[model samples]
Target chain A: MSPGGEALSRILYVEDDHDVRKVATFALKAVGGFVVEPCESGQQALEKAAGFAPQLLLLDVMMPGMDGPTTLERLRALPAIAGVPAIFMTAKVQPQEVSRYRALGTLDVISKPFDPMTLSATVRAIWAGRDD
Target chain B: MTELMGAEAEMRDALRRLRADGVQRLGERVRELSAGWAALQPRRPWDDADRARLGELAASAHRLAGAGGTFGFPALSKAAAPLELLLLGLRDTPAPGGDRLRQAGAQVAAVAAAWEAGPAGAEEDGADPGQASPAEHGEPIFLFAEAEEQAMLSAVIANLGYSVRRASEREVLEGALPEGPLSAAVIDDAVPDPLAVCARLAGRCPLILLAEDSSFENRLAAARAGVEALVAKPLEVNELADWLDHFAGGRAETRYTIVIVDDDRLLAAAYAMALRQAGMQVTSVSDPAQAIEVIAATAPDLILMDLQMPGIDGIELARVIRQTRRHLSLPILFLSAEQDTERQILARRLGGDDFIPKPVDLDRLVTLVRLRAERARALRAVMESDSLTGLLNHARFKERLGLELERARRHGTTLSLVIFDLDHFKSVNDTHGHLVGDRVIRGLARSLQKRLRRTDVIGRYGGEEFAALMIGTGPEEARGIIDHLRERFAAASFETEGGSFGVTFSAGIAGNAPGGAGPEGGAEAEAMISAADAALYAAKRAGRNRVMVAPA
Candidate 1:
């Protein structure tokens, strides 16, 4: 189940780093069996959001030009990804900072230096625990 | 259990295949990141550009730290985490000092070297992945030589995977300089009048000269021609290719200092650990009374202080710091658990730049500190740096000289100064207009800034004149460095309306060498300056574009 209490299949992951995006895509696809569409930046996420019609948004927090929280805010303005839950991935997440991410309407904050092995499982847990 | 064991085995095999395919590329990425980090190293005091670059480095390192751990290089991740933290803290503030930057750079270098070494079995045969292939990043190497020579060299360069662009000396001189950024340039010394061609391209890219003769005269000519490396002909193609690869791979790095003050030892340690992990040189003071002394000694770019202490509170401490003329503009950030709006407002009024509540979120704290520190640094740059050349201004230069001189005397170390004045600078201004003159000055400033070691203090002492304070350097070593720079400047061509022209400077070195008469106080600084000036006159009298050392 998705964080929105729906079956999560398609994930729109927005991360600027090419390597991180590649590894995350491998985890979600090969391990979790989810269809993952990756965007390099917030602007790219917006341009591809509607066409891809992703069920979840996995956004990196510290990106050049436009960051994750700003991306989510812009995406919320659009009808396509509006109310679609996002989970922020950032090295900056302290416990209080995680609360700030949650207040931004994200499903949760996944601190960076994350284990690739359990990443897919962690996302699934967050999905299952989502109130909506 | 048997079925599960079989499934786990299958997964392990798949993971191994993935790693084998991916690790090489990941290693390359790490090297690229390291090079980028190196390129961002601040040559001077932190400015707007340096701050922006710091932010970029932090963001990139943050990504690497996360991805590196996930991909089985836990060591790489561990190495990058501190860099990320350090950059985040330094992103907004002026860098702390050169020593701090060096420490941070060493940390990054360690990580980069580790990645280049790679993990056992990650590679097919333990070959250094960095040397495996030339970067296929679409950047082309420009070859400036005769037609026949170009044919032989282009093939070797191209074989290494770099795109090669060929141009003859005549083509380059006729204003057919390549349109894009070049990876490197190869020039055959047989070309007629190659100095002019080489001079134009000197600092633009790395230039390697292929010479038929290795005679002293021929090598001297090549040096005068502004090429970085001169190859005696019958060029070993493999060696040339390796040199090209090495030239293409260089990048930058920098470090910052932070001072953390809190009455709670454990809390102070926590903050210090976080900052240090980011590769920052951190000084923590748990006793409020010691804060002033530590701050004075460190002269840190940012002060992270807790609000409440036994003897003196953060607000009062900040006020005391502000009262001191030297640190009046220093950024003071309060990290406290106090939630009272009135008290926070009072702290702000007493010169607190920012306030973070207690049990501070480490990430947020770092970001906040960096922003505040960077802003303070940029403001300092405006007051401290010359508007035209971006070096230290005359006043700041003298001020810093006094400080360095005093420090050298206390430590019983040598301090050398080089005073340089451009030759025929007035004529250039008259003939080519002031704009071109300004360009020449700026070019020389950039050259000196780039070429000198980070410890050297450079300043625009006067119009068409510059001075550098080489700490821990004697007169002879200072002269050698100055002479090298003179040669480089003489080979550099400045663009003018009349076409490009070369400019050179005459320099004089004066130092308080060991067992020599040294400056006793600020008054004697003027005498030392005069000595250098006298030697400079001697250089101009003997010949322009040369260096002279003051007699003991």
Candidate 2:
């Protein structure tokens, strides 16, 4: 996927809810036309992170086991996941929460109750400005 | 393209099915919340197990809030938010209470009520990924305070007709996206390192420092923190509301009316379109013969007249308009190819406010019209205030009613017109001198100013009748406010040279919201005034000194 490096092609997505993961898969794969690895828990993400290298990280902030930030921390230990741009999606969009996520090395926080229709485009937008 | 369409269609189909599932899930959550509220012990000490159970309930509410919000049921989501917050607060503390707990039940009931209200604007946006969200959930006002203060402050802001999103206690935000596009932020002065925190938050939103004393040092520090406004700690709601309104920006601009009097139909149409697009109500007079009639009917803020015409020139027409005392100060800009310096000078000397060359740029024309009309409206506002009450005089009051009604129609907001006639004022003058009656009127005016917001328009409609225009206020709310005013007025005793005398005035309120059906028969200000007048008549018939709402 990185051979044509100019275009973003893969995303590592971790969310706790099955329904949300399904919707996200459709949005990121079918609509966005990008390869996606949708993990139901941060533990699953840790297990798969090294094998399925991704250009971006899309993680749900609140999860059943090992929430988004902790998951991202663990993922950074994997050699394949180094310096990958990450985004947090959560209903906790208070300014402090956004800042906390940013300080944790995420690109930005996508407010939960996010329009799934715009999810793909939002992902691409974050990836487009990665260098900035 | 075919493949793309196929995939898109499948996506839409999937979204439709998911939305249905989301609705069912939401219904389940509402039931779960109701059950959770029912399970709560009002007076019992909350144990760890109880707290955990309540935490699950809060989680349910949080899920419902997020799902409802995303599934196009914002009202339900908004109603669920407070419940979730309340539960969070309760779960954190051991103190058990009945009232706030009951209030949590009430919040659940509201969520159920909103869910019963059903989904609005759901189907259309199914396939339209880029469809803008309905402004039903306008950018909420962020209450950046401790959890203790947040609930109280959130209630206050919500009562002002704005939705509220609050920060958890001990929240520290250094960079962007606090509550997602905050209309304004209220900073608790007790927050440690408050000044530095505010400085970090400066450009994110308009920061309002809620402080005990606006001492010079604090004020200086506040300025450095880029606080746009301040509210004294003793939190006067009216002052807080006023500051919030000031910072909310987009305070519904003055929609100035313009009269375009041109002989050439095409040029007149062009000017009218330009001005109308720029939000000025434009009246085009292609036949300059009826210019006065149109201008009088429109009562325009400014006139754009053509300098050259076959029968009468722009200067000639303006000369005629200036002859009328009422139209004397009305700004008139003349459009003419007759660019002779002498003609321009002549036009300026005789009632012409400005000279526009024949081919005027539409953008420049719009800017000029806006600037001129704004000045005219300001001047007119001064000229329009009643000498006796410092409210708008009858004619100007009527004009503003029309303007405000137009605005209400445009913005889909609410407007209420109140007509107050002092009961048996002739008798008051007979009993006490006319000076006493005048004092009575002045007294009522002061009472109105005291009770109503500064944004509300008050006018001396007649010698003894007063009118008030309330913007963005619904009928029931208007009635409540005015009824309170009516009580205050009746209670007030005006002390004169001889003795103090009490007076009472009857008030009738008529209000309209876009798509709202009521006694405001026609959306026109004339109809509203008459409706209010009829209600006032009914009040007088029933017996005086009562506030009556116009009936549907």
Q: Score chain A of each prediction against the true chain A by TM-score and list the results.
A: 0.93, 0.92
Lowest summed lDDT window (length 10), candidate 2 chain B:
B128-137
Place model 1 in a CAPRI quality band: incorrect
Runs of candidate 1 with Cα error greater than 4 angstroms are: A1-132, B1-256, B272-281, B287-298, B310-312, B339-346, B495-497, B513-519
Query: B280-370 in candidate 2: lDDT tens per residue?
Result: 6778888788999898778889999888777988888998998887798899998866758997888899989897765555556888988
Of candidate 1 chain A, the 10-residue stretch with the lowest lDDT total is A1-10
TM-score of every model?
Answer: 0.49, 0.44
Give each model's clash number. Answer: 18, 1
Q: Please state the CAPRI-style docking class of candidate 2.
A: incorrect
